[model samples]
Target: MNKTKNIAVLGGDARYLEMVKNMSKSDDIHIELVGFDQLNQGFTGAKQIDLDDLELSKLDAVILPIPGTDGLGYIETVFSDKNLQVTKEWFKKLSKHCLVFSGIANDYLINSVNEAGLSLIPLMERNDVAIYNSIPTVEGTIMIAIQNTDFTIHSSNVIVLGLGRVGMSVASKFAGLGADVHVGSRSKEDIARATEMGVTAFHMNELSAYTSQCNILINTVPALVVTNDVIKTMQSNALIIDLASKPGGTDFDYAEKRGIKALHSLGLPGIVAPKTAGEILGTVVEQIMYEQDLGEE
Candidate 1:
């Protein structure tokens, strides 16, 4: 038997606008847009409603924005001025087997979902989403480096910290542009992968050693790898693009104190290419829904 799935999209940017459009194409999926009252564009097959108007007991799922929460329950809303917040109490009201989707999850969200006995899917943890997001991330990194530096990327010393999905793309793209690309990593397999990609690979412990000669230092590691000690060794004219999550990995305070241009670039895909980023998320969400039988054809 076919069943209708009710999903609420709560507090998000332009990407969620496109996601709603994509998800609503399935007639069996009914979407409610909350905290988007100020958005001028009308969502087809979706209704815009205030969060207070939602009947939590009837909802089958909830979709949160990529940035999700700020380690608190406050959601990011660009379209409205309303203060939108969600907590474990709200999650507990949802129907059984309800699914919650977000680009990423913080401690508060993780705890809330666990306590509610609901499933929380952090979509960014998926390999496909990470790799897809890497394209826009690399482009944005190059753009930032170019904008901040007086020298061209070609033949410049570029050191990429980490060899994760995004890090690998950043390294290869820069290497293809004739830059002297060097990748730092703790994983032996990642180091070998960087070497196989024809870029210089070094241990992360040797990061400070390369900073002095590096013209553009890109850190993708989500930890405090670029501390004051590391930034102190970097050239004053160098550019630092930290692609890690919130608060980033770079010591922005010390980098500024040293006069090095450091930028903590987050949500690069949404910033550089919103439609594509949104569609990638939409595709994945649709796939997950179909696989889980959350909705029927």
Candidate 2:
């Protein structure tokens, strides 16, 4: 006889709801959901309950929404009107052996989880998850580019900064759309790969030289790669889409001053395709739980 794994899912958006629905289909898993009453749909094997009713000690794993916690520790829940806080005190209630999983963790979350001596897994850091996530991100980026730009993608000169998973996807998609794509990277290997993909590749140092000709500039690096000098070189009508996290990699103030349209598009997976994004996350979580069960055996 095997014991069912008990998991607590905390505040999240529509993707989380979809994830809960998918995960609840498994009879081996019992799900406890918090901050999701406003949603009309319900999971088959999941119970939506107040946070106070949750038994932290009984949880085998704690699943947080992709955004994890805001810097202030408040969890983002779109379905619930009430605010939900996953503070250090809440963490303290969890069993020390419980595993905590989320997309990205903030400084406060990292410190708190470390202090509590619990294992924390950042799903976004996983290569498999990040690579799969790039698909939706690239689709969303293309949608944004089309909506914001006056010209078609057919002949636009697009510059993609960073040759990471997301960057590569963006470059390939634009090129497939008949755009003249240029990829910028710090790595020689990445540059070579980009060139092999039939796109022009340049070292990061040459960003300013290429920015002037760019009709669309997409940044995947989470650093200050697109500085004031780089922004200064861009055309006035150029669209700057910073796909990086909060604060992004672009000089927003300078781009605004130059009359360029700059957008910081974060969490594209959840925004553009919630069902697919949720399945991606739910599949990973299910795999993790299966491995954990095998290990226990």
Largest TM-score belongs to which candidate?
A: 2
Which ten contiguous residues of candidate 2 have the minimum total lDDT? 1-10
- In candidate 1, stretches whose alpha carbon ends up further than 4 angstroms from where it belongs are 70-72, 294-297
| Residue 174 C-alpha lDDT in model 2 | 94
Q: List the residue pairs that clash in candidate 2.
A: none
Model 2 C-alpha lDDT per residue in residues 147-177, reported as the tens digit of each score: 9999999999999999999999999999999
The pairs that clash in candidate 1 are none
RMSD of each: 2.2, 1.7
Compared with the true structure, what per-residue lDDT tens digits does model 1 show for residues 129-217? 99998998889888888888899999999999999999999999999999999999999999999999999999999888888899999
Error of model 2, residue 118, in angstroms:
1.6
